[model samples]
Target: MPSMGCASAIAKIPVSKAGRKNHNRHFGHSEEILTKEEHISAMTIEHEQNTNIDDGEFDQIPQILFEGVSSLKTIGCPGTLIPVTNQTRAVICGADSNNVIAAASLLGRGRCLVFAHSGYPYMFINVDVEDRRFVENCRLWLAKGRNAQFVLIDDTQSLSDVPLDETILVWNGECIKNDTFMQNLHDYLRQGGALVCGATPWGWLQLNSGKILSDLPFFHFCDFIGIKLTENYSNCSNPMPFQLELIQFKNIHHATQKLVADPTDIESLCIVGGACKDLNVDVSGLPIDILKNIAMKAENEVIPSNSCPIQDKCCRQKSNGLCGILCVLTSTKAPGIANFPGDFSHPPVTETHVIFHIESNANEWYCTGYYAVAGIPIQIDVLECMGAMGWSIRIGCHSDHLEVCF
Candidate 1:
């Protein structure tokens, strides 16, 4: 029997921590103190409210994983300061004045809960009941509604040896140079198998070679998944620099951004392959000036075109008239329509690739990808235009199969 995907069940989570000496130096303490032990105040943010399932309402995966628990008392530890990628898809459940302590990420059909330092393991050195309970909650959240049988894959074994249908692969390796593994992984995702990737392909590519190769397997993988990995890296202790503002949801027949009150509801999938709108919700149309602004941003690479046969096909489905929205295409190359900007489908589907200029380290790093939203389903991409850079929130799905990346 096929088990759930990586974040759903079996997985390997990497934890990055700073050295003790650096930790002391960072806190402005004397080098003589071997260890600095102090309780930090962690504030919790409520991203979503629980819904009553019995009332026929769609229940959302609690964005705040640490429910009822306000804060955790821990010895001031040094861990990776994880930046928030997407607000709707992830929640900073716990955070001190300076850093994020705990969070939960909801992907396609899988869920993952993350903590700062050696979370559960740290309890052995100093026990905190809240930490223990939080760890327990993380366990339940990941393992909920599934069996727990796991398989370990090392250099001795091949991914082909394991049944793709029966496993969810968690790959945290530095780089995947193997051609066969990449091909198999692509097929697995198309078949609705999920994956949890610790590092981005650009992280590997930039370190190896400064240029991106279109023929590379990693390039194909990112194209297939509708994500663009940049050669940028986040600076030390910098919080997330961008915020996504939900634009107006308009014409299901032509718009790329789709909003769902509840992502888990299967009825939303009716608009999956087809762009016809069957729902009776009011259309908060996108502003014309905003559309022109987006076009102007991509003016260098975006060529204005009105010859979309797909839009014509979708317009025939309903009585709604043709939307006169202009279309833009990126110059990036891949195998298929993944790079084309259009109203594709739902969460985890990237409609078009956003272009970014490579600059010096004076600017912060931002990567673009698709993530399933909790309260509302949408996708986020980092775009720079008119000397301003921020997150561009839109909805699109190019994949026929449902899978998620972490």
Candidate 2:
């Protein structure tokens, strides 16, 4: 059965005094340490609160095996098939049909099956026809057994109805249902199943809801994929034209590849991808490449960056007089600006002081004042560019002033 590549490591750590001390130190905590049993109990409580499922529900599910053990021959397909016995593992993803199909094909060799669903509830409600059809095809393929296992749980079925065992949950972004599913998912993993989750656009999942589910194993699960979902996606404001540049990342499981997507336009204001656990491998290769391609072919032109002049910097001194300082600065707030100036253009001004100015009408203004300065020598990259830069500068009584400056 395909085992959880990362969870095992978390479990092996001892919970004794030394282990607790190590964990506390590693996590930066000096609070009381819980014993192994205590930790499990806490996790159980947290899981239940998040998933809204009882221990009974999780225990009733059968164990799923992913690696090593093998059984049933085939699902009447060319790919290898293992018996859906108690130990048979399964990956349940809420991805588009293409990903479902591709992931299924790639994971078919494992002693597990892939269960893909059509677009999540949000997409089902808003996507256009072509997009809808694409999702339908995914559902159809799974239902027809073209892939491992295809199941659909729409508004008709309450999340509670879904059984949990050796199951993996994948969503385009994050899930907002509640703790019920999360609890059950935890139980399923404890019972032995790995969850391969990716939050595309990085923190895009959090946009669905302001809540953060980082406390759960979801954050830890991302390690296997090689990326860390950041709390910000502001870097995507001027999403590169699909064809002009394709952002690719490496993956531990697969080689790098282009991400294909509609080229006309992309949601520039959302999180895209972020830091990876493994820099050598790009896990976001497939989806990112696909999305990038789609955006390139898009009819809409790419948006510009919004530069702010609030600069921040960090400096480190090496052995000799040599020192490296990293500096970051957002351009003065401007209306209608989308993209941040490229780092190459605004290379750090060695020993130079950067200044930011802003002017805005009193009634149209958003804030009283905002200013930042950073002095550094290291190369810096403008995180994101939104659009025209503007700021309001209060000059005595005539404070209501608006000026457009980049």
Candidate 3:
């Protein structure tokens, strides 16, 4: 809910007690805490590297990189429906590199900075040397922007040991106990920082053993987790079938709800390119494409402008297969009319006392029938009528002095 500002400005804001309380409620005390020295060391290493190309030509870099840089802004994790600024960053740790990479790609296209762990691929796909290199390339691209930074964290360390003061923490994979690290992570997130995370299927099994899954501070720290603690089930699956999915928070309908209470604070974000199908197959033996389509539809349908009546009306008319009429009266005969493309068809024009009927159904009115206007008014019924036949219609009128075709 805070305005997009410099990272320094964000860091200056004091952590609220409520945030601390929330953190305590989720993650219990850990044995190994991250010393202040370690945190500093990590940040130092991250800062030392110049991820950007030394050549001043910004155009030399891949467009994806530029897009990623542009998208950098304060993003509410898991619930990153709206970007808060142009330099926000996401911190992903302990997850498979593949899922992180996929998510990073989506976020980057949206202009958000992504900081992910350099561990194993998060998905089931075999991540070879080339794949690993691509992941690193993404990091470099993200680093090029003044708004982005890619921090490669050591997997051996627990998430709790890492500093999460002003970052949106995405904790994925299995649990690594470090009470101090958890406390800091929780504190950072509870103070209005965003987080998105998911446990591995194996971790879910462990949780099923009466381990009090929801009791973990990180579980409650995030706005939404892939899995449900109380129910021990996940509404989503890994290797998501779609490039991006809109995560719905409790009682929030609009995507901008996470950014601000105002209706105008949100903007449309894009899902450029990434693997959309699930890496793991389901029991029905159906292709992952089905799930991918479902997710894509869910995400795309939530565009901020979708609430506008005019937009909805246009979409509705298209769905009903009705093209609006555009009438033009010309003095040219036949006029060597061009055929409508395959995407559209031309309607037939008959001269038998044609009656254009506008039928109203629900809240919309559409042309439903056309009557023949023949001499002496002979009624003719046509089974099918095509609307908007062509750019122009031909009319023939005969007079006593001259035969005119218009």
Which candidate ranks first by lDDT, i.e. highest? 1
Q: Return the number of clashes found in candidate 2.
A: 96
TM-score versus the correct structure, for each prediction? 0.32, 0.28, 0.28
Q: What is candidate 3's lDDT per residue for 104-210, written digit by digit as tens?
A: 21121111222221123231123344344443444444433232223323263665554533333344534553555655554443233333333433244344432
Assess candidate 1 and give its lDDT: 0.30
lDDT score, candidate 2, position 44: 35
lDDT, candidate 2, 95-204, per-residue tens: 11011111221111111122221123233335455345443443333223232222233321243565433223334323333334444444454443333223332233
Please write out the lDDT profile of model 1 over residues 1-406, one tens digit for every residue. 1111211111111111212321121111122223212100000111121121111111223322445544444423323222222211222312221133333333333333333332323342243564565444444444453433223332414566876554444443344446556555544543434443333333444455323433234333432232222232222232321111111111121122432333222222222112212111112123445433332332211232335333443323221111112221121121222334444365453333334333332223223333332223122233332332221222334442323311
Question: Sort by lDDT, best first: what order?
Answer: 1, 3, 2
**Cα-based lDDT for every prediction:** 0.30, 0.25, 0.27
Evaluate residue 210 in candidate 2 and report its C-alpha lDDT on the 0 to 100 scale.
24
Off by more than 4 A, model 3: 1-21, 25-130, 141-173, 183-198, 201-208, 220-254, 257-406
Candidate 3 worst ten-residue window by lDDT: 321-330
